[model samples]
Target: MNSTKIPALSENTNLRYANFIALYFAEGLHMGMLFVGIPAWLAMQGKTPTEIGAFAVACSLPWTFKFVAAPLMDRYAYLPMGRKRPWVIGAQLGLTASFVALAFVPEPLQNLDILNIAAFVASFCGALQDAATDGMAVDVLEDHQQARANGFMGGARMIGSSLALAIGSWILNVHGFTAAILAISAMIGLMTFVPILLREQPEEKILPWTAGNASIQNQTLQVTNWSIILKSLYSLFRLRDSMLVAALMFVSMGSYNYFETLLPLFAVKITGWTNTLYSQAFATADLIGGIAGLLIGGYLIERFGKKRMIGIYFFLIMVITSTLILSKTLWENSTFLYGFIITYRWLNAFAKIGVYAIAMQCCSKKVSASQFTFYMTLGSLGSMAGATLIGPMKENFSWDLTFFLFVVLLAFAWLIMYVINIQKLTTQITNFEEVEPADKMNSLLPNF
Candidate 1:
């Protein structure tokens, strides 16, 4: 009779997941814009490859450094609203404003310096929003729920990206840049209301001046000191599984970023396709892949585990990508090109959920936000590196050789991942519990 109360947020888990998914969809919309839509538009406008690649670097730069901001959310929140909610809301509003700011940058896409500044600022807000969103998931979700939540969130982001690429590209093609951007900004602004209306815990404030109070459960879990976070992080990272997983983050999955970034150029500039046509194809591919990630990936992860599932997916990716080299004569066929893009995006389920589930598992209760964010940033850093190298790589190498190199990197990353022992990681979690005295444990955040 006494155990009926929900321990997390005093709300149904499905509602909580749905709210988070909506926010992630917003995040995805902008990410697709920056990473794909903007670059494709630039290519359409006759921007040099160098300038387009440079802009991508500027936009992607913020993600690699978002770990610096993660601790801020972890350490302090407007607790009455929720531990992570204030940062999420603030960052969301900032994201909306930044897009408005970006739309009014006063020059066309070729104005590299001005455009880069606007892009960087928007991306910074995005990074902050991502940090806060991630913290909320860690705070509210049970260990068992992380994989599916990650899959669902990843799917939502992809779907949002699909819409942005498709709809944003159409608007850009017909009405020009400002209209397209403002529309996207409006969509993002509208979704901000989800977090505004939903409470992280029962009785927590929805707004600053509202009547609600902070949850007592949230208070007990508050992180109290900077040094303790650092100490806890060191203890967790020193484990072999942690070290290996960190390296895997730094290498595996970034190939998707490299290929995805290059596709806009490949489709628009090389294949003589209209930017709108390229975006529509990419969007449809994203939709198919997004749906697959949302449903099929989670089910497989439940059966085969993250390690085995990622390995299988990565192997399939290698096989499919190889067909690109073998089918050189059919390169100009729109059907073949679209099929490759769709297949590759589907295989990207490894990036969407498997690695994320493992990283969330690596997060200790005391430094969940910081540790989890750092792991995520490591992967972003790898992605940035891959995106940065493409312009030069394309210039120096044949297309087939370039793909071979990409596959080589993924192969090496998979080999490293194969050595990781998930069984040993649970022991580390248990050992941490034993090492911290019960009284000291009470002084720090616990997983909700």
Candidate 2:
């Protein structure tokens, strides 16, 4: 290694790193649009609260089942583009097609089923893309680069979502739903170029098949199928103190979804807010919250530790929910109502980021992708349960009661975290040493 060649080599490495970050960011942006833009667009179509809730559930289903297909990326190879790139490209094409189809649905309000089916297709592709992108990020980046990659990935998602909401709102206002869908479709198509331009690292090769190793290879192959996916998913419960952690993730996500699902309805019912006002407030909260969360989450993960930060944030969210409920009682007071809405929304956004970051930190690298996906899936379960319960709660109970119920849920989340000794779990994961290969190999082939 020539001394003079070192700096030039470093520069080349830097360029490659930058390109990977750019590709990750591009993927994030495309995914964010599907997450935020499409939902808001649907809400604008005059969908009822329950219908909106159902749509949210439908959109999240693919994510809940992402583990089923996650192994395909790990086990297979795409000789031309690499293992992950093929999945990414295919997903992008599928997403683009779905969005384009959405553009042609006449009377979107009347064609609710068609809209949902299109959204489901888009969600499915997005889920696959997310899994491939996650695996690629892990495979391509060294340990040192993981943090930076995640930060850029998070930031890009926020930026994409902000742009999507901003653009979708304007298009909905001026050109209507069809035009908005077409414009979004075009954006999705443009994002496909990202995977096309990016290069994938070579796949990691497991050992070749042999009589004694046959059992191990068979097990590895089994792990690649849906049966093992489900088994691994079930293994989530086997982790020490995982129940409470799972509960916390579930309730926090549920509350967040409940608040979001009912937000437009809340605005209309309580404040008599117009569509524009509702859209602006909702979008603003999301953008601000996402940005704040991304920045502060990284900071808290560094400073206060993941466990303490989660506790503090959950407490804050509880306070916000309480205030939101109280604000409903004071709805006639415009000044108080306005202040309450802003503060409540901001806190809600802030707490959400904290909860998510904490959840991410809890997953061990051994099963990082699968565990994280499973946690997300559990959150979806929470959302589904909340959506089903909230409507009847509102009809039978009261809006204030419903909000209070959210507060209770948050409290439940906090209790679960406390009982689970979240700090211990976090410390265990943070200080974890990689399993020894000898031990790993033994475990892989115990009979041998």
Candidate 3:
């Protein structure tokens, strides 16, 4: 697209703001239902632990491959609606329909065939929505607006996840699994209106997929289909200290995903709590932790700097993860279980905020979206790895041993962060002359 033809905020600031908010809300609710709510609901239906893990893997697989489709969204602008809006709208509609279909599907946990198919469909649509929404957010927002946008998007995601887990769990507990599914689907459908109300600004020209523009076409090509994807992969590796950054990304995200995927199942196995109670506990912890982490992360980054905060956060996470796993082995009572889970979630929330914020801070302006997407995709490896590891660990070792293994993973993560001296790296990169003014300004803001 002719970048200059992109609409200026000065012409329609109010409309743009309104659209951003609507889009934010729609995307947030969609994510909450698809990610947290639906999976938790499936677990409630007596699905096997392995099945739950598989579903988590399925849902996140799209994010892992987002780098593939990101290019197309970047290159091709929908003529009338706008560059990113059409995909956003279409994905939302598809997600809504998928949720509605899920509402009609019979108890998936009870029927393996039906559950697998439904889960696959839901995950596919959810992944599409995630990629489109992410691209739209990047395409529309100005550089200065990114931090605020991040905060708004992160907050919405937190709120939506909390509500989905809490409310979905409650509905399932009080009524039945069917009712919960239908309710979530209806909510997803209702969110469709938000995108409809938003207006899109037209682009002057479109970039077509071709061999001639290989150098500039990082965002539009699918990794699976396009050879250019391979070139971008190599470019990513060639970045200064790219290996350290990649390791940090893997450990940070992998640790978080591993715990997240297994938590509900862990609750069921150890505590014997119903879905409602489990959701309530999980939501409560996440809400409190997320809010606190956001506040503290902002303050610490502003006061102590990204690297210092990252170091502190990584250490804290290691200690906390170890404590949580050890606590599982040491204390088996109901009261202790409740306390342990709560504390673990809270600490995890804090660590997550710090880790993610620092990671974003590390991105160069030229490749911010691409790098961010790539990090997330690589981080997803941790989830898959965790799933793979958990299966084997549970088969041979005790639950306590598996939890301890998680602690070991966190420690390994800590060691990687320590060796990289991420804080020092942050300072070194920030000193680079080529860093854009806009990016420097964003670097000063609260990220995660």
Best by TM-score: 1
How much lDDT does candidate 1 score? 0.80
Cα error, residue 373 of model 3, in Å, equals 2.6
Residue pairs with clashing backbones, model 3: 68-222, 68-223, 70-219, 71-219, 71-220, 71-221, 72-220, 307-423
lDDT of each residue in 20-50, candidate 3, tens digit only:
4445455555466666776666665667788
Give the Cα lDDT of each candidate: 0.80, 0.60, 0.59
Q: Candidate 1: deviation at residue 290, Å? A: 1.3
RMSD to the true structure for each prediction, in A, is 4.9, 7.2, 8.1
Q: lDDT of candidate 3?
A: 0.59
TM-score of 3: 0.68
Query: Which digits, one per residue and each the tens of the lDDT, describe model 2 over residues 54-95?
Result: 777777677766867765555554433444556667877887
Name the lDDT value of residue 77 in candidate 3: 46
Reference-based lDDT, residue 29, model 1: 90
Residue 207, candidate 2: Cα error in Å is 24
Q: What's the true lDDT of residue 22 in model 2?
A: 45
What's the CA error at residue 243 for candidate 2, in Å? 3.3
Model 2, TM vs. native: 0.71
